[model samples]
Target: MTSITATSAAATASTAGKVASPYNNLNETDFLKLLTTQLANQDPTNPVDNTQMLAQLAQFSTLSAQNQTNTNLTTISDQISKLTGVPIKVG
Candidate 1:
């Protein structure tokens, strides 16, 4: 039972990690699979609250959006820095 649980957790974690990157390009199916797995494995006696699950999904969405926005901002900043003809040096 321990091994099975560990394997399941690892698989789920790996899937989540893959989708963590904004550029990974996940679809609705992948998101649904993760949600399904969470629901399926939740403890029956003390199940996860629907509100909590919704919050988690919302958080993930927000994180993904933020990552994308950050990437775009970094690109724009680099372009602006280059145009400024100033050398950005770090100590």
Candidate 2:
């Protein structure tokens, strides 16, 4: 039983480390699946409020959009810096 539990845990961790998307790893489909699972498993007596859920979803959408925007800005900045012979430091 102990060995089985260890193997299961290791398998779970290994699967989680696998990249599902080559670009934008945390995409909409993954986000929606997680949200659905949370909703399905929530406590019935004190369930998550509709307003809070919508707000959370909106926040996720905003974060994803911001990440895309940041990526685009970084790419453009890098291109401009290259043209201007300026070194851009990214951390």
Best by TM-score: 2
TM-score of every candidate relative to the true structure: 0.49, 0.56
Please report, in order, the local distance difference test score of every candidate based on alpha carbons: 0.79, 0.85
Which residues of candidate 2, in runs, are more than 4 Å off?
1-29, 43-46, 88-91
For candidate 2, the lDDT comes to 0.85
Worst 10 residues of 1 by lDDT: 82-91
lDDT of 2 by residue, 1-91 (tens): 3456888998888997685755557678888898899989999999989998899889998998998988988898899899999977644
Error of 2 at 72 (Å): 0.7
C-alpha displacement of 33 in model 2, angstroms?
Answer: 2.2
Per-residue error for 77 in candidate 1, Å, reads: 0.8
Put down candidate 1 lDDT per residue, 10-79, tens digits, no spaces: 8998898666676468765778788999899999999989998899789888877988888887777778
